[model samples]
Target: MTLREIMRYAGTLYSANVAASVVTFGVTVLISRDISRADLGIYGLFQAYFLFGAYASSFGLAPATVKWVASGAVDDGEFLTFMALRLAGISGLLYVAAGVAYLLSFKVLAVALFALPAYQVFSVGLSAARARLWRRREALVLVFASLVTSAWIFALLLAHHGYWAPILGQVLGAYSTAFVMIAYVMTRNLPRLRWPGAWRRAFWGTALPVFLGSAVFAIGELADRLVIRHVLGLADLGVYVMALTLFNVLNKPVHMLSRVLLSHFSQADHGVGHAGALEIVRINLVVLPLMGLAAAAVLPWIMPFLLNRDYAQAFPVFAVLTVVILVKAIELVQSSVAVAQNSATSNMRAQVVALAAYGMAVFFLTRAFGLIGVAWAVVLRWTVLTVVQRLDLKRRGVDILPSHLLVRASVAYLVALAFFPIAPWFMGIAYLALGAVFRLWRAPRAWRLAIGRAQN
Candidate 1:
């Protein structure tokens, strides 16, 4: 696809993501406000386990599916069959694990384990849809599923169901999406399932490192929550989780852009080897830090009203986390480049080192400081990952941003941080104005080139 086409598709996907994110954010706010803080903390704990289970059951198969489907190396039916077989094997083990947890009276852990297969199925379906460039269909699926989940949870809350409402709503949503996607696939002229030896080998070969890396990263992501729960208690965990939820909502646009760029860069011509990577770096540098500043400026005032006055304490944690979001946005672009280049090992190594560092940092930092330390630990982890990924890309001859651009962006971020506490509204307005100036100066030429390419 031409650059214009990619941008158009990215815009579509971003719109869909934004809509879903907005609804999801609303649902989260409702849950936080309505549910007890201790229940919210339990929910957060369940989520951490759910994420771990989902990533573990995926075994990197989702990305493998995307890579192969985009490259036209695997037929849909064959890929589906492979995923089914893999899911069966993984689910069996997970079921046993869940049973053991249940026997031990670990209800939430068991529930999270039971939800794994459906989560993986829904995830893989989305991956497949993206690989096929079915952005509208993918968007519809996501929005519809989120709406269903939100509605169910709302109904349960109205009926006076407690924490189980969201948990069950999540499981129901996963199954609903999985059923719809599977039915859609069945409507296609897909061949009967068969065991294909070569494809199995190919899938596992590509997936193992991605799986290991994702699993490690997933564990690292949960470390802070676990520490808070153990050391600080459930109410604090609830506050931190709510803060992170807000961070995720604010960071959704960058996440969507990175998702689109992964597929776009995978297929685009890289004659000089760094065109896609450089474009991603430049775009993120312009967009992410500004978004982070805006969030930092606004979240402090809005969060209390959104959740409760009790959550007002989470503002400082949220502000520190905006830096984490900024750094993560850049790191995500680099990681997408690595994925697109079929150099998953590079990312795997970077994630391994970063996860180790994150684990150690969270342990000590949470001991020294409370929830704020967890936020800072996250920023430190992402910074290390970004630096390592940049070095890896540089060694591979990719032209990253110039040092001057990095310095300028860093200075702008520091200035925004300094201004946040004193005059947050002014900080937001000034950052937006600077972002506007940067876009006006930089984007026109890029748009012209994209249009030229599209016309050609």
Candidate 2:
């Protein structure tokens, strides 16, 4: 496929994922409104733990699967079966661990633990859909899963399950998606379960690098929860988690872009480096800030309207995290290209460095600045990460970002942040004016021309 075709596929799925994520985001709104701060904290911890658990156990299998199938290095059935058995064994250990938690009197989290297996199954299947470029199927499955999460949460909330409501809702939605994914596989005729033949080396090559590098990053992503709980207390964690909930809603598009880009980069050999990198960076610079600024514009109203006073304190943290968005948007391009080029260690190294910086940051910043400090520390983590990854890319002849454009995006963010605490309305206006001055939207046309040249 050409770069254009890859981008087109990414666009199609991005639109669909956005529509589905809107419905899913409503579940977050409902949960935040309905639960108390302590309950909210407990719920947030549940999500963070299970999500990390899933990512850790899956061991980058999702991206690895995308690389394998997209590159035509593995048969879909054998690989799928390989993943299922592998995860099944891990699930057994997880179940045992959850049982131990229950015995230790953490009943709520223990029951919620079942979501891990559900997520594993869903990811294994979704990886197949992405590999085959089954865009419509992927979109429909996403829609179905998201709707299930929404409907189940609504039902559970009305039934007064408290924190248990959202937890159970996620468990059910994941299992529901897992069921649908199973059907997708059955339609293709299940391959006889067998050991790896020629694909073993390819399998480990992608999986090990991805897992080793990403595991530390995953820990960093969840570390804030632990820090907040220990230093500030559970209610404070709940307050901070509220900000993350909003951020995740807007982050759906970024996630979609990475998934699609990995497939594209795996297939298209010509635009795998410098020029391809530039186009994606430009696209993210246009989209991420727009999402953050727009989301920021409504927060002064939405926080008060949707949440209680206690939970509404997430505003400052949410605001600071918006700055992180400016940096994070470009990561999809850097990461996808690195993995596609078989340089997952670059990501591994970057994540290690960032996580270390983030640890010290949380230690000092949380003490000095409180929750907002934790938030700024997160911004610091991503900034360090992006710089490290960009340097690695440069060494490989993939200069993913231009200095001027990077500065433009950073300047626009600083302007927005400067005015944000005073008046979010002004922040929006300032960002828009800066965006105009910077001509952020002009990248698309240039990106098209660039891709055209690179593809040729």
Candidate 3:
């Protein structure tokens, strides 16, 4: 597909994601007012486990699937084998989480255990559809899943089911997505567990680094919640989780953009793709920080309107973590370049270093300063990740950005942030003016032209 086509498809996918995110966000907002903070915290831990399980069990199968399907290496038999591979790899994670859930008793969280792998199935289907550029089908699947989840949660909430409303609702929603996706894919072909000798090793070789890298990152994420829950109790964890939920709602645009960026990056020649991705990095260097400023300015004001007084403490954590979205957006673009270049070990290296930093800091920080320190530690981890990934990309000749530009952008963003609490409207205006001074106001046109020129 041309840059135009990929972007058009991205727009469609983004719309679907927005709709789904809105539904989930609406439920979250409603429940935030009604649900106990501790219950919210439990749901937060459930999410931590879900994310860890999904990534740990994936074995890089999701990306590998995208690579294979997008690269046209997956014929009928190949697709069947891939599907079988995904199922097999995902089962152990389900079993382990289920056992934990049972030990905790048949609670709202048991639903969490089931949903972990269920989400993987949902993810795999989307990965496949995304690789094939099946825009409409993928959109429908996402929207339907969100609708089902919202329906379940609302019903349960009205029936006075408490936390189970969101917990089981999320689980069933994941299953709904998986069911619809599997039903569609099954009509095309059946899954088969094949004993292909050489190709199997070849696939694993390509995927293992990605899997390990993702697993390490997932461990940090899940472990952070565990520690927080153990020390500060569920209330703290809930507040933190609530912050993330809100942040994610605001950050969905970048998330939506990332959904197709890997496909778009992979669709082109490696050098061209890397360049295209770096171009985006350049634009985001201006766009993201200011975006963060805008969010930082308003999120404090918005939190009260969204949540009641019970979760007022969440605001501090949320304020500290606003930088996460900015850093993550850059990492997303850089990550695509790493994966597309087929030097996946670079990702492992960067993530390993970041994980080590997070591991060292989270324990001490959580103990000392509560969730605020934990929040800062989370910030440190992603900042390290972006820096390490930048180094790796440059070593591989990806030309991430010039040092001068990086420094200037960093300083400018920091300056804007420093002025924000004093006079936010003025800060926003100053930030926009700086972006204009850098000629980043023309980025929309520049990005389009660059994409066209850089695409193969």
Which candidate number would show the highest TM-score if scored against the true structure? 2
- Candidates in order, TM-scores: namely 0.91, 0.91, 0.89
RMSD of 2: 2.6
RMSD of each: 2.8, 2.6, 3.0
- Candidate 2 has an lDDT of 0.79
Tens digit of lDDT per residue, candidate 1, span 358-378? 887887888788888888898
List the candidate numbers ranked by TM-score, top first.
Answer: 2, 1, 3
Best of the candidates, lDDT = 2
> Distance (Å) between predicted and true CA of 373, model 1?
1.3
Candidate 3 least-lDDT 10 residues: 402-411
Q: Which stretches of candidate 2 lie over 4 Å from their true place?
A: 1-4, 191-194, 270-273, 403-408, 432-444, 447-456
Give the whole-model CA lDDT for all candidates, comma-separated. 0.74, 0.79, 0.74
Model 3 clash tally?
A: 0
TM-score of 3: 0.89
Task: Give, for candidate 1, the lowest lDDT window spanning 10 residues.
Answer: 447-456
